[model samples]
Target: MSPVVLFDAALALGVLGCAALALTLRDRTGTVAAFMLTGLLVALSWLRLGAPDVALAEAAIGAGLTGALFLRGARRLGPLRARPPAPAQAAAAALGAAVLSAALLWAFATAPAESLYPPRVAAALEDSGVSNPVTAVLLNFRAWDTLLEIAVLVVALLLVMTLSPPRVIPDKLGALVQPFARIVVPVAVLVAGHLLWQGAEAPGGAFQAGAVLAGAGLALVLGGVRVDRRVLRRALTALALAGLAVFTLAALASQAVTGALLGYPDGQAKAWIIAIEGALTLSIAATLCLLFTGYGRRSAR
Candidate 1:
């Protein structure tokens, strides 16, 4: 047996074990932890399968950010009090999981050899000017997907703002976390910028960069670095709208001048892509920060 094959087989087994443990874990905290572990393991599996981009995504957005969200939710929900599962219910859950797993394994083992769309994507990439097919697909061929994803983010922020109750900062928590925020926020900003720039040809991108920036902003808020409401609100709203507005305008201009939406005039594709990505980076950052902080008026102490 080859070492590569042996390693892949081990990773596959490990992923299955983690999945089963996550499903069967009685404690909510443990379940969340297991899920996070599974995400990390899945990232490793992606690396083993020669998908480094996917591994980066799984590690960052899937494992790190999702785990942070889960931990925060778990904290809000407080300590879990375990309840015994009824035998019949447990049996049914197990049966459902087993059936689902079997179906997934069968599909993986029996799927057809050829993909339906890869060739079409490759054929279109020359016109898009991005060497990476995924990048071309995301930013050029299927730019609409990116546009709609930004819209979904906006809707999510609006929903959170509408649903969250008004909160007054507690003095104790504010005092405790402020010092750490002072040190971390600037570092986070730097990291976000690097990620955004690196995303042009690397694994990092607007979404990941924005999330990191938002994390910093959330830290500042939690630490009671008071925000100027009018400034923050106006700035955030503009940033949130900038990506979509810029992209739409670019697409419309292209259509008028070149006859197709988002179809750049000769030699302008790279410029347009970079411009759109810059706007997207800023917009995504602002939206994520606002969503985390919730809508509120902040005044200096």
Candidate 2:
């Protein structure tokens, strides 16, 4: 068999295994784990298809960040006990899922290869000054998508905040974790910075970098590194709005200079994109950290 055929078979098997595991898992946490695994496999498939940008996004946002969110949600919901589904309901659900999946597969398989937006995207790429076409699409040609995605993130954070239970005091950690966390957090932040900066020309970006930083912050919280409530709250709010605020301001300013929102006039496109991405990275990190920590007063050491 050809290598391509072997690879395709392996990918298909992996995806099927994940789907089966996800369906059979009784525990919510286990199901989420399966889902994340599925996402990782899908990302690998994307890479095989020669779409590294999509693969990066799938691995980072689809698998990593989303898995984190699901795990956090499961933790908040507490112990999971699976209730046996009624046979009829289970059958109905299975049928529906099968039908939907088949329809989707058929549609995709039959769809034309031609794209209406590619020419426009290609034309804008040179002027956008972004090497990656995906980046150019998100930040330039169709910036509205990026702007809306930011709004969605803000809404998600707000929803999490609203639904969160009242403050629960955290357990006092013994001395061992604090020193380790202190050292690790700074290193993680440094890594996140590198990822964010390199995103312009690489696979890492604001979302991925932010998630890495947030993961670091989450470690600190879990390890009982002290955080003042007032400080944390203020920081969370600011970071939550930072991306939207920066993007909005940039758009408004661009209107006057370029006669188009988010259109950078002259050669300042790269600078503008970097500035927005930096702020977005910070905001995303803060929001994810806060979401993981839940609503709580952090003890000030």
Q: How many residue pairs collide in each prediction?
A: 0, 0
Give me the runs in candidate 2 sitting further than 4 Å from their true place. Answer: 78-82, 166-183, 296-301
Backbone clashes in model 1, listed as residue pairs = none
Give the winner by TM-score.
2
TM-score of each: 0.81, 0.86
Per-residue lDDT of candidate 1, residues 68-131 (tens digit): 5666566556666768689999899889989998999999999877876988987776777556
How do the residues 233-267 of candidate 2 rate in per-residue lDDT, one tens digit apiece?
Answer: 78887878888888888889999888988888878
lDDT for every model?
0.74, 0.79
